[model samples]
Target: MATKVKRARKANFSDRECVKLLDIVDANIGKLTNNNNTLRANAGKKAVWKMAAQELSAMSLVQRDEEDCRKKWRVSSLIGPTVTL
Candidate 1:
């Protein structure tokens, strides 16, 4: 008899979660570009961010806030006005 094997399913991230993941990638990229030595010092983090960015791109979940401002504004319109303290 052949043995049965189960594969683990990948978790799906919501749009908000995707945004947070991209934020982490952007932060790591910023650190790498801010200084020459930072790239070497943060090699592990750089690799992690690079992989994350690629994954996000592949999933078509990465978006720029400025570029998607119109879409965002339209969505926010349904929320009514924001109150400032």
Candidate 2:
């Protein structure tokens, strides 16, 4: 009898591959930071911006309405945080 090991299914990505892929993407997308922590932090921010517009567009009912997205993406609440920057 042969013993078999079960592996979990992933979204076609691996930890080792993820790190290398991140490194490459980060290098191409932005300047490298002085430290690993700073590099990672900045990379996270970049990832958010990269996916947000695309995500909003996809999730939105009005696919052709970029203006609707710009409005919807904002914090419409008066007491909420404003886009000062």
Candidate 3:
């Protein structure tokens, strides 16, 4: 019998990639807001923008988690309570 081990897949993406995606979303949003008939009529662009927003949000969450982990691993000194005369 063979045992299968589940491995966690990394969701790491380069900052450049995230920035590019955000740029695309911003452009699309601008187009949609400009009353551009072509862009307004295209449902696909809206879907793409939604997906990009989701991706950006996910990346932000990942970054926050990494920062929290790093903070957790740091050594901290405990200060004794101060007494006032």
Candidate 4:
């Protein structure tokens, strides 16, 4: 049997702190994907790659917005929210 370590909530990271995340997402999307699948075609691969890159960038923006909203809420003294791990 193995022991488990308690996980703590991640402190909200700001936009500037999320630079590496976009790079990692871009570099890893196809790395974990099965490109041989039929939903993706050979000629369309480049376009798909570009779209994935854009999507990851958009996700970074979304994360920043979400963190900002959460921080604003906390600053306003909102509570009764239980963060689940």
Candidate 5:
């Protein structure tokens, strides 16, 4: 018998949550925005993201992990704010 695989729950960030996440990211921009390919730089980026997740979880009702925060940041940056004419 094959075991069923469980999928992770989706994260929906509110406007306030998004603002908080951006604030955290901005504070750690030096570490998070580095483009170095070295292992140390990659580790630093990971640490920063993890810290951001913790900060978000503490400030809000929703609990977010490092991967969740990372994915949300990517999607947010890509789509950005939409303006309707």
Candidate 6:
């Protein structure tokens, strides 16, 4: 019997990659950060995130998925107040 170890993927975002992500999120700002609580707005936000992830991965050296993009956005939100966008 053999035991296998799971490997962790590298998740460091380069400065250029972060800029690309910011650009994508900026392009979809309304849908991504809207405060409206309606179902249509919620669904649109999801679609926008998916599209953002696709766009980011297409241009980025690191292939980021939808969840990855979402996580990065959430992390970036902590500095939202300071950043002028």
- In terms of lDDT, the best-performing candidate is 5
Instruction: State model 1's lDDT.
Output: 0.49
User: Which portions of model 5 show Cα errors greater than 4 Å?
Assistant: 1-11, 82-85
Error of 3 at 17 (Å): 1.0
Q: Can you write out model 5's per-residue Cα lDDT over 2-75, one digit (the tens) per residue? A: 99999976557777778877888878888888889799999999998888889889878888899988988888
Give candidates' CA RMSD values in order. 13.0, 18.2, 15.4, 13.5, 3.5, 3.3
* Model 4 whole-model lDDT (C-alpha atoms): 0.44
Segments of candidate 1 deviating more than 4 angstroms: 32-85
- Ranking the candidates on lDDT from highest down gives 5, 6, 1, 3, 4, 2
Cα deviation of 75, candidate 5, in Å = 0.6
Q: Which 10 consecutive positions of candidate 3 have the poorest summed lDDT?
A: 69-78
lDDT of 4 by residue, 1-85 (tens): 8999999554454443334333443465564344675644543444544444454446564433333432433453355323322
Candidate 3, position 7, lDDT: 100
Clashing pairs in 3: none
Clashing pairs in 6: none
In model 5, the clashing pairs are: none
Q: List lDDT for all candidates, in order.
A: 0.49, 0.41, 0.45, 0.44, 0.82, 0.77
Off by over 4 Å in 3: 1-4, 30-85
Stretches off by above 4 angstroms in model 6 are: 1-4, 79-85
TM-score of each: 0.35, 0.28, 0.32, 0.26, 0.76, 0.72
Compose the digit string of candidate 3's lDDT tens values, residues 36-68.
Answer: 557546565456555565555565644323232
Deviation in angstroms for 28 in model 4? 1.8
